[model samples]
Target: MITQLRVDDRLIHGQVALVWTKELNTPGIVVANDNAATNQMVQMTLKMATPTGKKLLIRSIDDAITVFNNPKASDMRLFVLTNSVTDALNIAKAVPNIEGINVANVGRFAENANESTQLSSTIMLTDSELDSLKELATLEVPVFSQVVPSNAQTPITALLKGIK
Candidate 1:
């Protein structure tokens, strides 16, 4: 089962490779991004970032969903990562055992930052991303933003309030 699906543009990094893996006690790390899955260099970097002794799997969104739904997957604790809100939404819709969806970091490096909405220090969402996030908020699973294990979980709904 997925302990959490984190939306981080950097995919795997110090905060994620070290803090989150230990915090969630998830030994299996899955990167569910289309770009990362097909890119050899990206996969290498993500693999290097993975904590030693923990397992890592890089798959496209659809392939990751297939892996998540496999009966054997229920026996393990997995932490999934996606680069965009849309990808996270797609996974959440197809998987039933996700504990939460963390909109940790996104749009920080987006070219259209000027047109995006600033939801938090780490989250800047483009118009299309915001639409996906609104839909994500309506899902049964908990959807929130918590940059690290130390930060409090801020519900996506709260951040969406008052925004046009």
Candidate 2:
């Protein structure tokens, strides 16, 4: 079962490695990103950022979804990470056990930042990304933004308010 699907551009970092993982109490951490799965450098950095004793798996988005659907996966608590809302949405649509989605950090490194919509201090989305997020909000699972364990989980619908 997935405790949460976090959308963090940094993938695994201090806030995620130390705070969210411990708070979610998920022993397995899966990074569902095609770029991270094939890039040795990115994979190495993610592995280094992972907390000690926790299991980390880096796989392409499709592969991660397959793992999520495997019967054995339901027996373990997993916290999944994706760099974009679209990827998280894809997982949530395919994996019914996700608890929630945290649209944390995004758009900082996006090439089209000039045309992005600012949802929060930590969240900015381009037009295409914003469309995907809107679709994501319509899913059955809960979707919110909470940068750390202490922050209140702000519903993605609330953030989408007044934005066409």
List model 1 lDDT by residue over 17-120, tens digit each: 88999999987999999999999999999999999999999999999999999999998999999999999999999999999999999999999988899999
Query: Against the true structure, whose lDDT is highest?
Result: 1
- Model 2 root mean square deviation, Cα atoms: 0.7
lDDT of 2 by residue, 40-149 (tens): 99999999999999999999999999999999999999999999988988898899998888899998789887778999989999988899999999998899999988
TM-score of each: 0.98, 0.98
| Model 2 vs. true fold: TM | 0.98
| lDDT of the structure predicted as candidate 1 | 0.95
lDDT of 2 at 118: 94
CA lDDT of each candidate?
Answer: 0.95, 0.93
Report the C-alpha displacement of residue 3, candidate 1, in angstroms.
0.4
Lowest summed lDDT across 10 adjacent residues in model 2 is found at: 107-116
